[model samples]
Target: MKFLYRILFDLNKEIEEEAIKEGIVYVLNYYKNEFILYIQAYMAEARWLNNNYQPTLEEYIRVSTISSGYCLITATCYIGMGNIATEDIFKWLTNKPKVIDVAIVLCRLMDDIVSNEFEQKRDHVSSFLECYMRQYNVSREGAVQEGRKRIVDAWKDINKESLMPTDVPRPFLTHIINLSRFMDVVYKDKDNFTHSEGEMKAFIKALLLDPMKI
Candidate 1:
């Protein structure tokens, strides 16, 4: 983390004027506060596991939104080299657009759907599956079926955002949509990310290890 801070410090020097650099530092500090709050919620979830406490669906979703790490990805992707983004665009995104919200929702729900089985075997926080099952008094299969429906709904929102009348740049919006698609592929059958010894491993080898015949 210290290395990351050093990189940011060096990056600030790339700005032409000291005033703009200082302003950027101030903005970074603001984002630091936001990140700390987000991480605190995740840590609180861990602490809740000690008591075997179950969070409501609302509570679960709220925390999952932050823990999904979409906020950091959106901030970096949307505010590019300043040509495609401006102060107005950044301010608009600060309000949290619908597309980004749904994209992260897709990520959190998909991850829980595929990973909750393994996660439940250990002392883990209450996932969406647990919240839904407890809330509705349903079986695991039932809860998963309903969770799949919500995932479909989130995709619809993502599709709508990708269309016209967008508040942010289409390119920025595409990055979020692509992230959802990538999550779908990754967590389709299992938690390929956490357990990468199967198809994901082969994929990595093909993409990175095996050199193409040039």
Candidate 2:
């Protein structure tokens, strides 16, 4: 953990030591209140393996939300995207606003759905699909249907947040929306991230390598 902290601090030191210090303080404060969350999330699958315990759908989703890396992504955007974004706005965003929460949920659920088939072939963590199946005593097909419903509901939350009046600027909120859209393509019909020998590679080549005609 110290290594991770040092790397983050050094990277930010290029900008300003004070900024790094403030970022550290923010992360420490966040962890002080929510440190147990990481443990619970990481240990979820271990508990399942040790005791054959399958968490309820709500339990699974709640814990899975933390492990979704939304907090890190949102914080990075606040600092990186906010060259002109004020400290107050960045602080407001780091407070886990509605838009961030919905975006995180969208990420978590869709990832689980698209990665379900691939992950099952290994000794992977118990996905939301497994949890839902055990909780409701449903078959794989039924659990998949339920999982799709939950994902759709998350999208509804994102759409509603997008339409509603917010204290932050639209561009900031759009960053989160774009994140969900990116996940859709990355994990659509397959877990392209983990098994990235196909279209994702082509995506990288086109986006980063291909020259555009002027």
Give the number of the best model, judged by lDDT: 1
> Candidate 1's error at 54, in angstroms?
1.2
Among all windows of ten consecutive residues in candidate 2, which has the lowest summed lDDT? 24-33
Weakest ten-residue segment in model 1 by summed lDDT: 16-25
Q: How accurate is candidate 2 locally (lDDT)?
A: 0.73
**What pairs collide in candidate 1?**
none
- Candidate 1 stretches with Cα past 4 Å from truth are 1-30, 79-83, 209-214
TM-score, candidate 1, is 0.81
Question: Residue-wise lDDT of candidate 1 within 109-200, one digit each (tens)?
Answer: 88999999899898899899889999999999998998889889999888887886887667767777777887887887799999999988
Per-model CA lDDT versus the true structure: 0.76, 0.73
Residue 182, candidate 2: alpha-carbon lDDT: 89
